[model samples]
Target: MRDVAKVFDRTGSTLGVMDDLQVALHTYDGCSRGCAGCVVDKHFKNNWRFRNIMTGPDMRIVGERVKEYFHWIQENLNTKSDGYFGTNGYKVDHYSYTFRFGNHSELPQDMLEEIAESCPSDFRVFSTAPSDEIHKFVDLRRTHPGNYFLEIIYDPVADRAQDIRDMVLDMRSNGILGYPEVLITQRLLQAYSPERFVEEALGPLGDIGTQLQLGRYTPSKTRGFRTTQVVSVDEEVRWMTAVAKGIVDRKYDIHPIPIGEYAVTFLDEYKEAGYEGPDGYIDVARLPEPEPFNIANVVKKTRDIFLSSIYVDHNLDLHVWSESMGQHVLDRNFGFEPLGNVRNRPIHEIVTEPNGVLERMLREVVRNLATHPKCSGCRYKSFCASHAIPLFRKWQEDDGEHCYGYLPVIREFQKDRPFLTNMIDGFKELGF
Candidate 1:
């Protein structure tokens, strides 16, 4: 059995801890789209000047490296006698990996096929811009079909709606096995109200079994340069809740990513509180405002935010996470530097070496969570630790302020708890 860590709140009540690891592979670093508010654009642009571009053969080599790394992890780390404890002193029991062929650039067909051939078992995600080449993905799916998903980055400001609809329709017509994931950034949410977005965008795509991911735009020095276009926490909450309600309504075959994850959290809190109305129904008014800084909640939120994920960028540089890939670009001494480039050394050597950079940084992040005044007192400290730690380290400011955003959505769901609960139950009954 895997050793489990006990997470406690300020009052010493027990909280749940996570025990899984995820690896994100970035195969390329140059994108031609030049979409608005691209999180990796600046980093990619900077690296393009100095970094060697990865060719198809280079990607295959990376694929082999990743496979060897995973085998080493399973043989050495994921054992009863030698469990892996990487994040905040939490032990991880299982490991899963995601391969994103083009984290920064649009994936070419040859590179996409190389990834497909290299990692046949792993869940492979190809990020590409809106182009006629997207149709080639259908053939890839037909030839090699496992946990493969194509993520189409749709910049509502720059891309046309018809293009998306046409591409999805083409995939369906060609007998593509699974739906392609579409990414809509915060700018689109700001441009169109949640209701309007659902009616105009999500509605058509959802009917076709396309999964939509709402990308939250955070103000980073490199990405989201157009600060004026960023949406507020309130607006984000509105969009998320509306989309979740749509899922509960069975309006589409689409599955909400983080929204569903958030729903599970809110559901747990609702059940634990046991608040009910006169008719034994959930009373939204009776629900208490969540204590974001409560130690147990903070730990759980940090676990959720982190998802025990690590990133390997195009240069074969291992980052703490995908978001941290650009930390050096933001500030050279951001502290969360790449663990070590895989090109120079094997991943196992870099990760398993005693007191290595990765371990030291993990300890440092946990220490900061406990000692940093802003983090110790702030409501969204967990988020700051897990998602925005690099930004926080650079600015010495709280980036987790948006932690409160989940409350409004929870409250809204509570208003229709019975129906929503029944819908979730029905989903289970149908084996979803």
Candidate 2:
């Protein structure tokens, strides 16, 4: 890892001003859908790895504990500011709950409802597998305005992809809690043609995001769980651009996070520095964001999302801009003291890196929904921050391979300018 050249004011008391009820829940074992490259696989060795929420005293205790977190949040953060309190710390392979209690038709209805009931109804997004039973839960989720969102996750190339997509669309059509997404990664795109697949499977809902976030593969899981087919940034950009354009051309639903802005912004920086292609390789000089990414010049362009209600599961630090990044930090009710620092250490390296974890983290911000680091020179010294956990979980406490798909998306989005400006805009504060 490169040395962290930039210095952060590590002096501040890491005061995390949290919201109402953003707790995190995980199975840690029992079931896994085997996402081609998953971070959860790294923790397979630990006994506590798979806590099996279905059995044991831990699950019973959690059921009650989460409720406490929820009620506490209602009084503190949710009513006014965005004090996120959602699920935290659990490396379950794929699906958390087995839903294996009764016959196929019955499913784990009662228990599932109980789990959902325990979590803060408004402000929490329950990340669940893309199962048929999800629709049932979505119906119930809609009853609560801000509490639940049926997080429908699934692979696109797999056989069940179509089934899952169909069920998701049907759910949306049926007015179910429809914040579902296609968890397609960059590596997966290499294996399959997303353009053709979206055309065939998603049909309409595929139009959700402007660019399907091209996620990267973690090193640990990369050995077996993830493929190490390292594609160059240029090619990655090409492929990502193609997929992004494909979605745009077809008018599919492509909700782009702030990372897309990063890509577009970077591209302009490269061109501004007099870039030129060499030996079939397009080259550009590096003109990184002035020493402090939080220059007033950059912040002048963005808006203030400070008052907005945001989740904080991934600990998305305010200093680090992200695609919203790999997965969102939206409402996860989890413990804070343990997951303080992001797994990706040495923030200095990550901010200006070329291809390592820092670059990837930046890529996530550019491609997805990102919050800019307008805090550099601002006097609003009391405001707290968050960082995406998937990319930095190990640094805090060794765990999973779930955050590697943002690299390509970052490279791709680096070409756009308007997107870049949008991202930079988030940095500026009212007082500044």
Candidate 3:
């Protein structure tokens, strides 16, 4: 029922780059899962006075906004002209969309069906539904066949871990995409007792056969009444490495997971600064390439801003990352003026307008990456150069709630390092 399609570029330009534009339409807002370490809860809600729990009827508006954007893509981006790939080129790839951004939100069944019917076969369907409704998504994929690829997140700490285990076991036994992606965070790791973690968490997948993947949880702040737990730098590396080692030593059927190499490569700047933890142990094993730590090797030519993908929030407001803070650049309200509206403007103009917010941001980002002193001398320039300025800008704007730490580039280096390392290795190019 599920399928995989190769994606080369989102802009459909003649350049043979491989960046994918993953547009996500948020079906709902406000998560009920209430994971202890969620950034939304820790930073957005507590500090910014950001309201959570926007759902139900609002999803219809999300669906409509996505439909409008999809319509625009079909009219403008998905063209029949072969010039997009040039005369000698054989394949052209369009930007793909997914209904995957928000957590603890449900989709209107009718809207899901409409999206399943409308998007290209390569469109991915990502969900984090509880175990009982997990099958509903699989069934949806079965009905749609090759139209979409299915990605489900099994949050081990989510109260339904047992149900998740049961469903994953069933899928693996029945050969249904094996086991879906399991997301284990420090929040989850610290939640369960060690004995329960081994018995309930790791025990179920003991026989899935080298098909599993160990994912590194992103660096984040866990909010507490009197203090905040900033899981950055050393902590992020340690936990991810521990998770990877745990998976490997258990003799599960997962791929190598690359946690070691990623940690090693991404921490180049830190190591250069002679930074070392109390134990002086580097969790991940290092890789040899990127010898001088070149940025060119990580990112390709086409400039990309952070959170470059398009997202339509629950309120039908189109959003993009206006700054490095990952704050929503809404097409409508929320006190901030948006770049452009999906409801009124064409897709190309919104993204490519010479003086648009995204364009200006991208320009400054590129300029800063080229000129910044630390970036000019740093080894991982390619990986962080594109958005380093905005990340710093966002940190200043938001007071470092979601951004992590006060040190200029230290937190930025640690925040998404593990994931970026895996992505860079996976794509053999820089990714954000």
State which candidate has the highest TM-score: 1
The alpha-carbon deviation from the true structure for residue 403 of candidate 2, after best TM-score superposition, in angstroms, is 14
Clash pairs, candidate 3, are: 209-253, 210-253, 210-254, 211-253, 260-284, 295-382, 298-430
Winner on lDDT (1 vs 2): 1
TM-score of 2: 0.48
Off by over 4 Å in 3: 1-20, 30-32, 39-95, 101-108, 114-121, 147-153, 158-162, 169-186, 192-203, 206-229, 248-251, 255-308, 315-338, 367-374, 386-432
What's the count of clashing pairs in each model shown?
A: 1, 90, 7
Candidate 3 or 2, higher lDDT: 3
Cand. 2 Cα-lDDT: 0.36
Q: Assess candidate 3 and give its TM-score to the true structure.
A: 0.56
Computed on alpha carbons, the lDDT of every model, listed in order, comes to 0.50, 0.36, 0.42
List the lowest-lDDT window of 10 residues for candidate 1.
6-15
Better of 1 and 2 by TM-score: 1
Estimate the lDDT of model 1.
0.50
lDDT of 3 by residue, 15-115 (tens): 11323444665433334456433433333333322122334345444445455545554544434333222232222244555554334224445555555
Per residue, candidate 1 scores C-alpha lDDT tens digits across 291-384 of 5555554444443333346676666677655232122221222234677777767777776567876556545666777786555654445544
Candidate 1, residue 321: the lDDT equals: 56
Worst 10 residues of 3 by lDDT: 1-10
Winning candidate number (lDDT): 1
